[model samples]
Target: MDVFRLHFDIDGGSFASAGNASVEVKKTLRQLGVSNAVIRRCSIAMYEGEINMVIHADGGTADVEVYPDRIVMVLEDHGPGIPDVELAMKEGYSTATEQIHNMGFGAGMGLPNMKRSSDDLKIETKVGVGTKITMVVRL
Candidate 1:
């Protein structure tokens, strides 16, 4: 299989459109004949990252690279960076506001879900700056 690449601009503060990018990525993977397990992993991880982008950052961009053996995803945002990576990675840890909680998120599961779905994950952030997360799933 050849490498396929895609990009998405996540809308900030928009719960209505949080999973759009992940949906599109799922479609792309289906079209590319990716395996069900691979697609599911990618979709789950990407959706969590997308939700995080909307909740924390005003908006951000996602870059997806699909290769024969693995899929790579990079989600970057300009929101306030995570103060503590360890705390943020906790399953029940979240800094989301009440407004976001009302929208069915902020359960503090996004990061943990992402970690669970991906074979590898990396997060880079600077307080008051932004965050960038990279995830990979083996095919």
Candidate 2:
């Protein structure tokens, strides 16, 4: 099977550049003739991951691998790791500060939304280290 890959560095501390990776990936997938439905799901999941990397981790890396039957998105960040992943996964549980809330984000939907948009999801985090999240979407 043919493969299409994309890599992006998410810039932390700047909300202005958030979601850039997702936008570029969407364009790349469209150019590759990926279906709109799959592109939408992939973009949404990537965008949410990007936003999280920005608001929490300061910055991170996102790698997207697209295959004939599925797409995988990996996001890695060197931020304060989540203390409780289960609680963080809840619909309205967010640890974002008021500054982030002022930006209209941190509603606690990022992980949940990512899970909803992807066929499979995995997250690994260490309190003092960082976080790595892998999300897969079936094509």
Candidate 3:
């Protein structure tokens, strides 16, 4: 199949619409006859990224590319960049405020889950600048 690309702008502070992009992507994948396993991994990974963008950044952008052999996702945010990527990647470690925690989110599982779901993951960030995460899942 030819490559397909999707772009989404995530709205920060909008819990009600946090996962809308992922849901739409899931629907698109379903319409394209993507496998269940692929859809599940992509949706969960995208959802986690979406949540991160909303909680940390004021807003952000997500791009998904569906290729014949793999799916590529790029999430970019202008949030306070991760101070310590190694620490952030550790399970149960988070900088999320209590307000976010009360929302039943920000349990520090986002990066870990993204890593687990994607075949390849890359994270780039700078303090006070922003963060960019790229993930790839093989089909």
Error of 1 at 91 (Å): 0.6
lDDT of 1 by residue, 14-132 (tens): 88988999999999999999899989989999999999888888889999999888899999999999999999999999899998899788999999999999999999999999999
Lowest summed-lDDT stretch of 10 residues in model 3?
91-100
Please provide TM-scores, in order, for all candidate models, with all chains considered together. 0.96, 0.97, 0.97
Model 3 C-alpha lDDT per residue in residues 46-65, reported as the tens digit of each score? 99999999988887999999
Candidate 1, superposed: residue stretches over 4 Å from native: none
Q: State each model's CA lDDT, in order.
A: 0.93, 0.93, 0.93
TM-score of 2: 0.97
Clashes of 3: 0
On residues 28-116, what C-alpha lDDT tens digit does candidate 2 reach at each position?
Answer: 98998889999999999999999999989999999999889889999999999999999999998999999889989989999999999
Clashing pairs in 1: 12-58
Off by over 4 Å in 2: none
How many residue pairs in model 1 have overlapping backbones? 1
